[model samples]
Target: MRATSIILPALVTALFLPATSPALAQMAPPPVTDDVNLSLQVEDWVKAETARVILVVDLAGQAGGVNRADLLKTAAAIADRTDWRVIAMDKVSDSAGLDRWRAMLETRLPEGRLAGLAERAKRASKPGQQVRIAAVRFEPTLQEMEAARSALRVKLYARIKDEIALLQQTFPDRRYRVQSLRFNENSGGYRDAAPPPPPPFIPPPEIQMIGDPIRTEVIEEVAPANESGSGQEDKMIVQAMVSLGAFAGPTQ
Candidate 1:
């Protein structure tokens, strides 16, 4: 089944929210560092199934304009060339917006797929810094995971980094320092994916000797024991018959 993708609305910094500075300050710190942290988190948005990437950009201080529109445009352009599903992220300013956001996420990214992260995001946002989060769900077909990781994934991150760099240059007063990170979706931290599953197990074939009663050959020989010539030793050789029975395993 084609897994459903929940595209969250891109959020503006706390400056855009209606909350007072004190109230916004009461909110929890950003999930990532306050610096310009840009990373990708690939999530299994359908339980243990389909996966997608969360391109999170965290900035410190009151940001003037992060240029989300241009960032999104660059993402769409990259998607066209890479065939990845990249989308802009959205923010929630109040309880009503939060409710609607949760409803939309639950309806789309159902069954514990992405609901937890949404809640966490709500908690992590604070007035001290601005955080921008986007998503990219590459082709979920089983065969495309590798392609997504190898080609599309790199392009996705590069585009994001370029945007962040441009923003830093344009708004030097903001002092944006875009951090390069390797994101782990599970822990929501900077790290690579876990080791892959072990290879499939194949038991050895079960062989039973049958219809081979007539078989054995032997040879005997005498040899000197040692320089002392204490005694003579006998050497014996034995062989078993070669036969065939009902086959079970692959012959090729």
Candidate 2:
């Protein structure tokens, strides 16, 4: 029998997928949930006072060996000596080379102090322990973010309250209460407040989040209250939704 090969033509068809991937699971947040909700964008308006000053200590491939732990300790000590407050000493992975020890410091000083802080840290380095300020940038502190979110919650609640009050006044008979509220961040995540809501009612709703593996709520929701809040300079908007799950019967 003659050898014959059957060539099957490849089928080429376009595959359709969602324009944007589905966001993470949504969840109700505390503090804000009690306030009310929407795909709302509230400005944190926090002063960009906080600055992150990163100091990197390169201990990779050196003729003079140094203990990694000691290097980190030395780096932290050096940061403390600077005008900045030492936030933490973190290990940064360098895929191209060995891991590096990074010291994170913060300051509320004027922007001009960044360069001086970097320079001072470099000058304070000891033998086999070189400290270099990798970067100095202005950002919001955890406290600032918390404050902004807190402010946003108040705003959301006020808006909701005004609307509900108006509606109740209009009806004059029906009673409306907030059943659930959710803020699903564009980052697809959110955080809850500490000291759980006073008990006696229902437990807080479960918050579901679908966001980047490394979630950053600050970058997601908070923004600096700059002069002209436009474009990239515009504040981050936290989107939320309110559920009026139950409506009591008309008052007798």
Candidate 3:
């Protein structure tokens, strides 16, 4: 009986120890429930600053109770981090409770377009469908969004520059460059705007061809220049060329 007790406890402990399976170790957590309510809170900092950070919260099942006060407190806790927008959801069965719930939302939502979102939430069916809200600043042009994204890129680049430098040291022969071009059109004659012309191809530098035995050069024909046009027009006909040599170089 004493041996049985000791063996039984050891067997139970071994059984409860974590199982090792390669497949189970790689699996991700289950997705959030479909009936979860979602809300957004715009922090003061986020409203004033550039980049936007959104918080997604789930209020479904008993993971958290479905009380309004509790939900509001949960939302407030999330909003304390930044000055951003908030989206909230409340479930109502009939018209009586819905009117009261909508009135509360009106008090929370800022005036103007945000109020419109609140109105949408009021009319949305509840009880079953999960509510979702998003907060984003209004920008007039694509340029503004691009500027924000560029700023973020710069910050990210700064943070990882050390790693990039280390990689460059590890691979000394490699070279990297960033190239960008822009095209603009001024109003002329055509009623319908035509697509921008294809970009001019620029050949790589000729220095790369050094040390080869058998040499080759690329030559391009040019068009004659008109006397009436500026001499600057002649430069456009100078075609780019690349020279290759027979010398073997180290493989990258």
Candidate 4:
């Protein structure tokens, strides 16, 4: 029994002692800095002369273990591209920090349809999902967006020509020119229809034309003098002339 007790204690110690298995010995520790893999896909809106750059960050493995600063820094770094405006979504990170970052981005970039998009993202997300950042490059103006919509489904090559023609017509006097037009398969073609034409140009009532005043002409007539050679005749003629002048006087 004494021998058995000693052996049992030894067996327990041996079993409890750590063993260096190949899996543990060869495994690499995760990075200390919360480094997430970032993948970028750039799509160009050829007609709009804009680009949509999608920045997909892998947050699946980072659950409950991502550094806020690192994530934000990563986002900011990705946004640094000159041709892209970063739109962060699926951000399964610190909500407050993400909101703050979004606010800061709004102040910095202050462009595109980011406000509406951000609002939509915020509404869609649950409590804690990694924000997926979508960056738009070369965003189109209202006019460009309209043109793109109109030219939807036109082959990429043909779309450029159509856009140029439209631009020429829309801005007849302006010396606008399109240097190049690129197409991206990811953007899924231009929108089907152009946004409704800006409300027709309705002239203000105050600006309506006022008609010119009516013109008038006056005519004078004289009666032949009586054959009788008398002072009364002269007086009669003078009276007649005076009457004619009075009738033909400038109209009021």
Candidate 5:
């Protein structure tokens, strides 16, 4: 009866909700007959552990144009001959919109190696058919992504535990236990989806999502890494359901 009491008012209010409830329609009513609990969610950023640097090589020289076959051979040579582990990245694409092609190369690219790679590409260039480095971009490696996810989970767990501890301290008479937990992979943010995504928010004493039973994870976008690619972040969120019951300490 105590658990049902916690959700009854919400269901009643939902039923009385006016036509404007369509706006509220996105907010699903709380589940009745469920354990009474407090739901909390937390989000944090995780810096990537590794990065892959990409270099674009333009085969279209000033005079004629670098031959595709020769350029591929050059790519092989660059990978094999270079001390720096430069290797072909992906499929070739249109260079400047003509028969010419652009090649993408990848490398571990430790600090201070950019200059060496650029100089090597310049030396490979010629008047009629030149091949030179055009641009560079940073990409997170698979390992780095995994690392970020792990970091995010750890952070969220720590926050949830803190919140649970606070709740226990706040209401010494009730015994609280975690009922459920859900983690969001994509950064949590409001979106235009059917049934609608919850607004960007966090769990608090008074959560606004209007649901009675479950708490959704709160995910936020991570700051993008700058040019150097020294630091990259992938954020994550975890939602926790904590139910409480009367302590009924030592039967009198």
Candidate 6:
């Protein structure tokens, strides 16, 4: 009897398998869960006398039991700087809250001031070149919040420096300095500050020349009264600031 070689079924399968096969040995990795909720955008608007800084924040997709008030306090601390003013602050957790804030802002901000901002933005843009505002977005973890805060602090310092440079560059003839600006949270109160009592309207001085017989009417040029009227009442000034969560950044 002739001796014949016999191959087992397992041996036949192993012979067909690729030498570099991963499907046979590797287990799939688990799905990743993203918890970060954060975003940022540039908000530039000219205030009555200076550039104001404001923050509108939303902590969306974050875990429950987060201290929102503490977050606001932290934000206030970061924004409470002499270089910039936080004209308005709001924190929302849901879409309804966001809607409410938007409605409130729309009513509070002045239409005329917004128009003026539009004009300024138009004028600032070069004829052919467009002025692009700088904006950034991030989704940082709880641990990364501190890093984000540090980055924001650095940005604020840079903004102060840039504002000073802008003043100097724009007004070379007039000596200008960047002063510390304080924010007044009470919008109604800010508008109610009584205007300085108008300077006692002084009668123009009349000069009578006895020697000159020719009767010449002396037209006195009196300077116009300073308009003490402030900007629109309760106009919310938006500024460039960072968002705290993985929230969607504001669009242009």
**Candidate that scores best on TM-score:** 2
lDDT for position 243 in model 5: 54
- TM-score of candidate 2 to 2 decimals: 0.47
The lDDT values for all models are: 0.32, 0.46, 0.31, 0.34, 0.48, 0.31
Least accurate 10 contiguous residues by lDDT in model 1: 99-108
Over 4 Å off, model 6: 1-143, 181-252
Candidate 2 residue-wise lDDT, 1-252, digit = tens = 233232222221112322342321122222222233334455444555645554445444443444555644655554443454454544444556565444333444444343355456667676645665544455656776667677777887777777678667876655667777776433211233345653333212211121223441111111223212221111435544775423443333
Better of 1 and 4 by lDDT: 4
| Candidate topping lDDT | 5
Residue ranges of candidate 4 with Cα displaced over 4 Å: 1-46, 65-69, 75-143, 146-252
Better of 3 and 4 by TM-score: 4
C-alpha positional error of residue 27 in candidate 5 after TM-score superposition, expressed in Å: 32
- Residue-level lDDT tens digits of model 5 in 1-252: 999998999999888888567746456543332234665565565444433444445444323543445555665443333323334322222435445334444455443333444456557766533444433434456665566667767776676677667767987656555566665565423223435554655544311222112332222212222224454454545565545344343332
Residue-level lDDT for 54 in candidate 4: 41
Model 6 alpha-carbon miss at residue 109, Å: 44
Please give the distance, in angstroms, between residue 176's alpha carbon in candidate 4 and its true position after superposition.
Answer: 34
Model 1 reaches what TM-score against the true structure? Answer: 0.18
User: Candidate 3 residues 24-57, lDDT tens each?
Assistant: 3344332321121112111111121232222223
Error of 5 at 171 (Å): 3.1
lDDT of 3 at 153: 44
Q: Report the C-alpha lDDT of model 1 over 5-118, residue by residue, as the tens digit.
A: 322222444556655566564574324323443444333221113324343333232224345544444333322222223232233234333211100010112222333343
Let me know the TM-score candidate 5 reaches against the reference structure. 0.43
TM-score of the candidate numbered 6? 0.18
Q: Candidate 2 at residue 2, lDDT?
A: 31
1 versus 6: better lDDT goes to: 1
